[model samples]
Target: MIHKLVTTPMNLVIKVGEKVKEEADKELYDLPTIQQKLIQLQMMYELGEISEDAFKEKEEELLIRYEVAKKKEFEQWEELTKKKD
Candidate 1:
């Protein structure tokens, strides 16, 4: 069975954000993408795979890469959606 969402106009952005977040969550653990690496860094930090200083360093690096990747993905999505408008 398929479920449906009942979103109003004002909730459109929220819905999209949730969808994007869901996609990001899925990709975070699947491979060695930026988000995946970020997930790894987070796990390492939590599980003591690296020192606090090392974890902080890798986390910062991964975060920067994640932001860049996320921006690119958003731009591509925006381009595609805008073309349909």
Candidate 2:
């Protein structure tokens, strides 16, 4: 009983922290942010701030991120459409 009492608060805190982190991550990696990041990467490459190899790597990473965000957005839209139908 004592152990359960002591652990319950900690468990609750952990769960809440996880939920907050998940939401924060979703916001952090949203489409517009990813797009802006790609633009920044391009500008960096053009201005000699980043090398061609680094630019390619970062661009690919951002493109993948954008695709993931787009996929999630499409899934959400499909869900809403299904609900309406």
Candidate 3:
């Protein structure tokens, strides 16, 4: 009983942390969010706020994230269709 009492709060905290991380990941890799960041990056480049090298590096990272987001969206759609069928 004492062990359960000690572990219960810890387990709850861990679960909450996992849930928060999952939500953060979803937002971070969201397609629209990535696209908005890309547009902002482009604007910065055009305004000469960021160097070409820095813009390119950030652009590449965002593009990679966009691709991953697309793939994940497709997979989720497929799963939903499979469930319906």
Task: Give TM-scores for every candidate, taking all chains together and pairing residue i with residue i.
Answer: 0.52, 0.79, 0.91
List, residue by residue over 1-85, the lDDT tens digit for candidate 3.
9999999999999999999999998987899899999999999999999999999999999999999999999999999999999
List the lowest-lDDT window of 10 residues for candidate 1.
1-10
**Tens digits of lDDT, candidate 2, 24-60:** 8787668888888988999999999989999999899
Q: What is the Cα-based lDDT of residue 58 in candidate 3? A: 98
Please, what is the whole-model Cα lDDT of each candidate in the order they appear? 0.75, 0.91, 0.96
Clashing pairs in 2: none
Residue-level lDDT tens digits of model 1 in 1-49 = 1233544654888899999998976565333587667777788888988
Full-model lDDT, candidate 1? 0.75
Candidate 3 runs further than 4 Å off: none
List where candidate 2 sits over 4 angstroms from the true fold. Answer: 1-7
67: Cα error in model 1, Å = 0.9
